[model samples]
Target: MTTGVTGRLGGIARHARPRGPIETLAEVSVSVESGLASDFRGAVKPGGRGRRQVSLIEAGDWAAAMAETGHSLPWWHRRANLLVEGLDLPKTPGTRLRIGQVVLEITQECDPCSRMEEVAEGLKAALTPDWRGGALARVIAGGVIAVGDTIEIIEG
Candidate 1:
């Protein structure tokens, strides 16, 4: 038995340079070799080592985190590659997410780092609990991913 595709890509964003501002995108190319095309992370850390090709954040969880901390910042402030909705992001490594034509494997929790504090005061603390921050994943099978694309979870 397998779960069906139940989530959608709520949003997409890219950070061109390290610590640079995020640019929202309608669609982007994905590859097992180079995560999201033109994204700085893949370029800076080429090769699929350490499972950091792409990052995903649960839209609902983000909203909760913001509401809890009274932070009204944009979703891109988290600097993740994809904003997912309608499905609980699996925190466990080995989980696979199929987004449109692309596929990603959950490598680890994209834990809230000190960078979250830079984005908003107390945000780091807010994301510390409940896996609010997001999930870090590596591109397993690659293709084009866009906003509104369907997302499927394949348990590992």
Candidate 2:
């Protein structure tokens, strides 16, 4: 049997282009073709185009990284599409998750990119260990997802 984990979607963020400033959102529309409405990466990249159609992070992990780095930047600075709390994001690929009306399949680890260094020195390294950086996923069944939406593993 596939084990499951439960959590809540804590935050959402998007931007128009690479390295662009993130815009926080209370709700977002998702689709197989467009992962998150209006988000540059989502609109531009179609499903199966890449494993990183959407990205997610754990709120507690972000906090831990902040405490370790001694910097208090906003969660959007992490550049993930979703921030979740209450469950540890599975590190293995192929994990399936349900967030509100949407279902997503974990494709790979959303490894810390060099851009993290620009946000704050040592931020990249701080997020490098323990799956603190979260995971990249692709939308399987899409719909509207809102802040405070329940998150749970459908399969893992």
TM-score of each: 0.93, 0.94
Please report the candidate that would top TM-score against the real structure: 2
lDDT of 2 by residue, 1-156 (tens): 256678999999999789887899999999988789978777434234557789999999999999999999988899999999998888888889999899998988888989899899999999999889989998889999999999999997
Candidate 2 positional error at 74, Å: 1.2
lDDT of 2: 0.89
Ten consecutive residues with minimal summed lDDT in candidate 2? Answer: 41-50
lDDT against true structure, model 1? 0.85
Tens digit per residue, CA lDDT, model 1, 3-90: 5748899999988788998999999998877779888775425332848778889999889889988988889899998999998888
lDDT measured at residue 45 in model 2 versus the true structure, 0 to 100 = 42
Off by over 4 Å in 2: 44-48
